[model samples]
Target: MANVTFTSPRMQRDLTVYAVAGDTHTLLSVAKKNKVPLESDCENGECGSCLIQVSVLSGKAPVGMALTEKEKTVLRYAGKITQAQIDDAETNDRPPPWRLACQFIVRHEDILVTF
Candidate 1:
């Protein structure tokens, strides 16, 4: 059981921060729970189509931290990805490479996600 939450951005009402289990976890969980709009075409990391930004809580538990090699390749075609992002994933093994939302289970708190 994780704590899921969402915080609206300062000015934009539609632009909000979605927290799954209250942390950087899965978009599928939060999207499903809050009914956030999504178009999960492949549902796998193969398409980089469901890419969403998320911020992990400080000192948060390590949830889904590594992208499969295949996912990394998809990200290569994701367009406009920075080496910094790749480095970030290298360090944490989770994050940046965009996890396959359908592959991992939810387990995190206080993650700031934008929809």
Candidate 2:
């Protein structure tokens, strides 16, 4: 299980929800299930409206998840992540701070998400 905490200025308080690791559910789905007000224009990775900042809270090295091609293009175009960051994520297994909630899969590690 993973604890995903969401924080946003639009919300009254922070919300934390549990997500099963390797469940193949996106973070956006988890947020929607929990009634978290994460704004998303498109459920797919094509849009960057669901972009969010994720921080690892497990006090351990974060396990990197492969980013989709759409995510790479969208994030890069939005100036949320650079090519160097993407390369680091792919090569060093280090995830970038910004990610598309629709494309992010929750791992066993706890994380804090900010929009």
Candidate 3:
């Protein structure tokens, strides 16, 4: 299980919910199950509508999470992330903060999500 906290500035509210995650459970799925009010289109990595900034709250590692190839392309095209950041993540084994919610799988770690 992972604790997923979502904070929406537009709604002026935040919710903390528990998610039972397996290898297939993405953040978007958990959000939908808990009614976190995340706006998403396509429900896949093809569109960038579900882009979110993620932070590690308490985990085995402080790093955020790895970005998928589709996430890298969309976020880069939208200017949400830079190539330099991608390079850093690749070379340093670090995680990028920006991610497509649809593509990010929630592991057994607590995370904070902002959209």
Question: Which candidate comes out best when scored by TM-score?
Answer: 2
Once fitted onto the true fold, the runs of candidate 1 whose alpha carbons sit more than 4 angstroms away are 1-26, 57-64, 80-84, 91-94, 97-100, 103-105
Candidate 1 local lDDT, 2-111, one digit each (tens): 44333334223443443444355456655656665554777766666555555555466555555666566766676535567767767865566244454434554545
Backbone clash pairs in model 2 (N, Cα, C under 3 Å; residues 3+ apart or in different chains), count? 0
**Residues 1-115 of candidate 2: C-alpha lDDT, one tens digit per residue:** 9999999998999999899988998999999999999999988999899999999998998899899999999999999999999999999999999999999999999999999
Off by over 4 Å in 2: none
What's the lDDT for candidate 3?
0.84
Number of the top lDDT candidate: 2
RMSD to the true structure for each prediction, in A, is 5.1, 0.6, 2.0
Number of clashes recorded per candidate = 11, 0, 0
TM-score (C-alpha, index-matched) for candidate 1: 0.57
lDDT of 2: 0.95
Q: Which segments of model 3 are wrong by more than 4 Å?
A: none
What C-alpha lDDT do the candidate models reach, one value each?
0.54, 0.95, 0.84
Against the true structure, what is each candidate's TM-score?
0.57, 0.98, 0.86
What C-alpha lDDT, on a 0 to 100 scale, does residue 4 get in candidate 1? 35
List the candidates ranked by lDDT, beginning with the highest: 2, 3, 1
By TM-score rank, best first, the candidates go 2, 3, 1
